[model samples]
Target: MNPYKEIENEILNASHILITAHKSPDGDSVGSSLGLLHFIERLGKKAVIGHPDPAPEFLQWLEGIDSILYMERDGEVLKNHFQKADLIFCLDYNATDRVGPEMQQLLKSTSAKKIMIDHHLNPENFVDITVSATEVCSTAQLIYELIEQSGHADLLSEKIGTALYLGILTDTGSFRFPSVQPRTHEILGKLLGAGVSHHLIHEQLNDNNTVARLQLQGYAMSEKLEILDSCHAAIISLTEAELTRFKAQKGDTDGLANLALSIKGIRIAVCLYEKEGKIKMSFRSKGQENPVNILAEEHFDGGGHANASGGISELGMDATLKKLKTLLPVYYKSDK
Candidate 1:
């Protein structure tokens, strides 16, 4: 039986609905959640969108973006909604822990029927209904499939199409990632036919960068980036002072790891930036030459896609940098 049919049945019977995505909401998370919110509303159902943290500035222009309640910012109100909800839709993330501490606790305590719609690998078996397809290009594309399969394809208006297109655009690295299938392009065509302005979405996400962000990117590439010729890797590390000097915002370092990957001989790119006393890492690799996901999981306690992943180090700046340098040669040898 199709699990989406079960999900549809749940949605039909439910009244008050709650929607949420992972913390540090990215385009896929926010876009998928908001796209579903618009779909449910069109069905005449009352739904509330909650996010664990603020959506990045670049995604703020999305329709219905402001309607999302930040769990960190509006805890009391979100808690009340959680209590009243008959159904909870968890989007993008595979685990409840990905929503952060407070929201994770509330989700665990809620009696609401939990439905997970994600494209991430190794999902936790927490939700009641799991509609996960790890091979899908993005969760937004999966949401589009869900709505179309559930017989609500007509509900996909321009607003919803735009949101869905944004997710597909970002998560697939502007359709450059190998994860994008022919079906992804088919959906992109349909989204465009549905009145989604692809050029506008691209401009707003990529072209409307602030001068400070560009300056920071320039500084990181020119001064901070280090090339490891032996391992065919590049790394960029930013201390808290550097971030502060650049006036770095939440999304400033979004694609810095990819920039390192653009280096001619660099197969693996790593970005280590300090945030709140811990080193947060983003890893990117070109084509599957490195298997950075395994490197992240084994060394840094993180797991993601084959080519892109993230991890963290509790070690101080210098120590973490030293640790990464130590691991590269060993991991690259084993990977080969």
Candidate 2:
């Protein structure tokens, strides 16, 4: 029996549906949620999209993005939808904590049947139906597969196709990541057939950067980047003052960590930025030399994929940098 058959049945039975993604919602999370929203509406069912926080400004151009309720800003509206929802679809995240504390509590208290469609490792068993495919490139790919396999291909509109395409493009690093496969290209073809403009999407996501954002990137590379040649590691730290000086926005430093990773000898790249009184860290590594997720989980109290992970430290910027430098030798040994 096809697993998606169960998912289809659940959707058929549901009337009032609610969709949500993790906090600090990225392209994949927001795109998959909106794509699924369009899918649900095509089924003649009413669905509401919610997120723990607002999406980045770049994603606001997506169709139906304005309708997504931010749980942090619109608690009552989200709570009301949560109460009335017959089914909830959780996209792109595994754990309830990924939705933040208040929304996590609401999710736990809700009686609605939950469905999870994610492409992440170690999913928590909190949902009724779990479609956790870590092998897939992104949750958007899984959604496209679900729709194609379940014989609902005709329900896909240009808006839905564009959202799905954005998710795949960004999450796979514009088809540069190893996770991308031939099937990903096939899906891209289908999305293109559905009228998604690839060039426009690329321009919107990448070319629409502000001058302040470019200045922030320049300052980070020149002034903040620190290299450990012996360990082949690079670290970048940005203080709140620096961010304010450049008028940094939510997505300003989106791909800044990758800049460090691009260095010739840098095997491990770490970006630490102060935000809201906490030091937020993003770890990126090349190949399988070092599993950044393990290091992040063990020391930084956070985890994600092997190559890419994020964590937070309550300590100040200086202390966090010192701690990271101290641990660098342990993870990236001189011999290795």
Runs off by more than 4 Å, candidate 2: 334-336
Local distance difference test, candidate 2 = 0.90
Clashes of 1: 0
Report how far off residue 183 is in candidate 1 (Å).
0.9
TM-score for each model: 0.97, 0.97
Q: In model 1, which regions exceed 4 Å deviation?
A: 334-336
lDDT score, candidate 2, position 336: 69
How does model 2 score by TM-score?
0.97
lDDT of 2 by residue, 1-336 (tens): 687878888898987889999999999998899898888788787789989999888888999999999988999999999999989999999999999999999999999999999988999999999999987889999999888888899988898899999999988878877778899999999999999999999999988888999999999999988998878899999999999999999988889888899988788899999998999999988776677988899999899887888999998999989999999988888666
Least well predicted 10-residue stretch by lDDT in candidate 2:
170-179
